[model samples]
Target: MEPAADASAQSTAERGRLLFHAGLCAGCHTAEDGAPLAGGRPIESPYGTFYASNITPDPEHGIGGWSDEDFVRALSEGVSPDGEHYYPAFPYTAFTKLTREDMLAIKAYIDDVEPVAQPNREHDLVWYADWRWPLGLWKALFFEPGTFQPVPERGDAWNRGAYLSEAAAHCAECHSPRNLFGAIIDDVRYAGADAGVEGGSTPNITPSKDQGIGSWTQDMLAFYLEIGMDPDGDFAGGAMAHVIDVGTGKLSAEDRDAIAEYILSLPPIER
Candidate 1:
């Protein structure tokens, strides 16, 4: 019985670790040479530069003192412990689809990690973008907080892949173009973006031959994800390299294959 208890604890920790990587928490939360999850990294955008917030267990600077409800609200509703609104740059938009179990697992992992006393840097938004009240209207316009529901028509692997892509990896967050109002342009999702996080170009992963990864096979895409090398032998650079290193590369082969399968299944849209 004791061994079973220990195994349960270990599996939870391990699942949290994988989910953290799959969720790409470290990609934004960890700065170069900074403490893990201490978050001082700045993400470039058309609106303004948004600094990543500290997510460590530090009581003062991190979420150490936050209640479980606070954490859920923060991620699901884009609200903070103090009832403040979070900018869309945090990608809570994607996280809102996460299950309560997975969310708490992430919290468990975070709570057990080494605490760092790092304060969050304020977002440097354009003057008009500084207000948070308008966010309520924005939420009403676009936000729909819900957990992922499996598709009965699809198999378990496909459902898992969809969950990972939409709720976990949030590939569309960068890959899709955004409207002037900061909402994703659903019509052109996965059709590549001129400006993404850190103001970098994101490639289309749809199966479009000319405009997307249509030519790539599942094996090719999975290998690229595992090693950060494109079909042309060019290596991914900048933010993508970081994501591969800290996120997808650390994922299991099966998970990587699932992502590939899901990506390849998308309808190709030429831009």
Candidate 2:
């Protein structure tokens, strides 16, 4: 019985590990030369530089003591264990689309990390940013917390791709340009950001020939996800390079194909 239980746990953790990579948890939680998931990565935003928190298994500094409900609430609603609303910088807006099973799987993977006692760095935001209670209002206006629902007429591959891109990889979070309010502009969804993270532009991936990846074949896109080399002989650089290095590059070929399929299906928006 003990051996069987151990196998089951290992299986579950493996599934969770897949989810973690797909979700790019390590890309955000792990800093340069820092302990994995021990946090301290600085995210430069228009407001200020927000630091990622320690997510290791440490009972004192990490989420080691978090219950299932706590984990779910943190991702699904961007709420903290103490009932405070977390800043949107954590990308809970995209994570809200994750299924409960996937969320638990990610937690399972996170559970395997050795506990680290490092403390989290505070965000260097505008003076008014520390008031997290107002974030509830931000959520009310712009946030819609829900799980990914497959489009009925789509094939399994397309649906699977949708889940990976929308819920797991969160492609739109960086690809789409946001309004001054920090909410994504619906009209230009996937139409590229003029000035994105680190003040660099994120490309339009909506299949527009004039501006997006319309000229690229699906195979080309999938291969790019695998090796970071686009069809034009140019290589992806900057933050995208990091994403491919730790996130999408580690995905299964089938998953990469699915992502390519779903991305090509978006409305072609010429930015």
Candidate 3:
């Protein structure tokens, strides 16, 4: 029989699995009609097409050989075990805010998945993009590695919402406009942006009634996350539909409400 600690570890991994879904890792990593986390998804960008890496437990092709420190470094510092800098498309900028405990939980869950013997695909970058040394300069200019800090004045729910939205869910990566360098424009956060998945537009999620989601009640937003059904009788489609299917739709009721509360509390922005 397995030891008590083994059972406890299994329970922690299960919680991690749910958190992984909430974080939308599978949505980005899984290719179209492909095995989950086997990773052949082609993410389009202004620079070129970048493929997501295989994160399964195959030692030769995936993260099976990675230590916990290796995993944390990849997420927190955007550095690989061999000291290669990862491209910004990985969203390590947002992931850098995750706590060590949360990072380990995510790793534990990933370790529990079945190993796939698929090799990682190379990126189809623009001309003269073969070199990775330039990423170091980019990181120096834009990347800020730190954990999420809760405001002492805010209540637990508000802080939790902030952590989940900013760090785990990385909502702004899609919702905010980016500069030429592909860095998010901090000033216009949640105010909507172009260059969404497959060239679609990401709508304003701010609290402006004229342009954003201020017309939505907290319940309405929560319901949308839970089932992708808006108050207007519209259902989410496209990339958002996929997000709802694999990510927000799987969150707990309290978490969905907390996310809505945090988003609705944002100052209105007239995008």
Candidate 4:
């Protein structure tokens, strides 16, 4: 029984490992192959220069000392370990929908990994941008932290798709357009805009007869998300390619199908 327990623990650890990769947490958080969660990566944005903060298990610097509740607060509440509001650049706005279990899984994996002692990089924003204290107001205006709203009419599979799109995957973070303060303009969800790497706009995914991806069948969308290839043989480039390479590539066929279904169900707009 002891050995079985140990083996189960190891398996859970492995799941955490896979989840970290699937979530692409390292890409934005860590420098190339740097400590798993000790974030030092720089994110360039039109708003200002941003840096990914350390998320490792280091007690002082990383999340090493964070309790499960602290982890949940960070992901679900957008609060740091010491109750600081994180910028949307952290993408907790999208991550807010992740279930407590999923958040803990990510935390557990982080805990099992090595702790990097590197200090977090500071943001180089202009004075107006440096007013980090206003995030409370920003959250009130643009951020609403909550779990996913399940669609009762949808099947479990479709619900799973909703979870991926709304929570773990956070497809809208890039695909969706943002207001001046970087809050997503949900009214135009899935409408096209320049958001990929190099500031390229994502093609609309709504089922619009012309302006959106109405022409793409479920299989095609699934294939594109999986391998970055379309029926037209066009390979996704830039940030989209990175997403396929790291995040979507790790999803199961069923989950991918769920995403496709959820996307297809959206109203098509001719934007």
Query: Model 3: per-residue lDDT, tens digit, 166-209?
Result: 88888888888988887888889888888876568899999998
What local distance difference test score does each model get? Answer: 0.90, 0.90, 0.89, 0.79
Backbone clash total for model 1 is 0
Q: Pick the winner on TM-score between candidates 3 and 4.
A: 3
List ranges where model 1 is wrong by over 4 Å: none
Full ranking by TM-score: 1, 2, 3, 4
lDDT of 2 by residue, 1-271 (tens): 6999999888889878877988999999999999999999998877778899999999999999999999999999999999989988888998999999889989988988899999999888887776777788989999999999998999999999999998888889889999887888989988989777666889999999999999988899999999999999999999999999999999999999999999998989986
* RMSD after Cα superposition, model 1: 1.1
How far is 216's C-alpha from truth in model 2 (Å)?
Answer: 0.9
Reference-based TM-score, model 4: 0.90
Query: Which ranges in model 4 have alpha carbons more than 4 Å from their true place?
Result: 1-19, 33-35, 195-198
Consecutive 10-residue window with the lowest summed lDDT within model 3:
191-200
What shift in Å separates residue 266 of candidate 4 from its native position after superposition? 1.2
Cα miss at 112, model 3 (Å)? 0.9
lDDT of 4 by residue, 166-187 (tens): 7877777777777787777888
